[model samples]
Each structure stands twice: as C-alpha cells, then as structure tokens.
Target: MGSPKRGHHHDLYQIEASLKEILSLLSEVEIDHKVLFLNADAGFDSENLRQMLEKEKIISNIKTNLRNNKTAKNYYYFDEELYKRRFNIEKANAWLDSFKALFIR
Candidate 1:
C-alpha cells in the first residue's frame, strides 16, 4: 500500500481500517502463517503501520527512506537480500510500459 503524498491530507486511520479488513479476510481463509513483506516506494513510511504489523506478529520487511528527520531508535531486522529483489518490481513496471496499451488514453 502506498502512503498519501506529502502535503496531501489523508487519514491514516482509514488506511489502518482497510488493512485490518484485508487481514481479517486473509485470516478467514485459514492463512495463519504468512510472511507479508511490504515494500513501499519511499513514500509509505509510517511507524504506525510497522507497529501494527509487529502487534499482529506478522513478519514484515518494509522499506523506509532515511531522508526524514525521524530516526529508528530500536534495533529492527531487515533482509538486505530481499530488499535487493525489489528492483524486479521496477523491471516489471518497465516491461509493462513497453506495451502500448498502458500508454494509450
């Protein structure tokens, strides 16, 4: 999930509510143990979401840009190798853009 752009007024509570609903649906399907790695495009950096994921005991590998003033004081685990794999998403996006359908109005 992408975070709202800076200066855009968005309610984080709404996003959290939607995330809860989605999680509930997934749980109803008997998916109890799932490694949900959330990758954001340097925009969806929210400590609240991270806390929520931790509270639910879900393993998340979320990317956080360190351009902001806020810093992480606690030790957090991250998969550097898996983070490298995120480049594939960009490659896939580029491949999709090669299709004329994506460019058409």
Candidate 2:
C-alpha cells in the first residue's frame, strides 16, 4: 500500500480513501470462510482504521506509531510473526518495479 506521498500528508489519509474502494470490491466478490488480515506500517496506525478493520472482521497487523505517545499502552493486539511476512509483499512490489512500463501506461 506504500506510495509516493505528496507534501507532509499522512499515510492514514490515503489508506482511508483506499479502504472505501477496497470494501466496495470486497462486497462484489464472494469470499467464504476465509480469514482476512491487513498488514500496514506504523505510519498507517489510527483508531479509525482499527474500527474499520474491526467492522470488517479483518485481522490488523499494523505496527504501533510510538512517536506521539511512547508511554501509552496499546490495547489492540499485534502479531509480530505475521507482520514479518510483510517483507514478502515488499519483495513482490520491488519485482513489479522492474516492469514500470507496463504499469505507467
């Protein structure tokens, strides 16, 4: 979900917009008895996103952004093991970058 951010805008804004589109697509598709999860960086952490994931029954593995409040206790559960697998997604994106011409068009 990472992309070039213009100016100082936060990633949460982009993710929020994308979520609507994603949920719409999900509604059009029929997924039966499958566990769904979302992996995102700390930059995308927010209570709003947490609520959205909760409502959709999607397991959220977003890292906590401790820059603002380092002493706050996170009530939300995070699975480090699953988050580690996010690198595989990054690798896939990196591989896709090699074919920039295909996407640019």
| TM-score of each prediction | 0.58, 0.76
Per-residue CA lDDT of model 1 for 1-105, tens digit only, reads 233345755445466776787787777887774566665544555677778877877776766557642566644566778878889987998788788776685
Per-candidate Cα lDDT values, in order, are 0.66, 0.77
Residue pairs of candidate 2 with colliding backbone atoms: none
lDDT of 1: 0.66
**What is the lDDT for 16 in model 1?**
78
The CA-based lDDT of model 2 is what? 0.77
The Cα error of candidate 2 at residue 26, in Å, is: 2.2
Per-candidate Cα RMSD to the true structure, in Å, reads 4.8, 3.3
lDDT of 2 by residue, 30-88 (tens): 55312588888898788888888887788888888988548776666889888888999
For candidate 2, which ten residues in a row score worst on lDDT?
A: 26-35
For candidate 1, list the clashing residue pairs, or say none: none
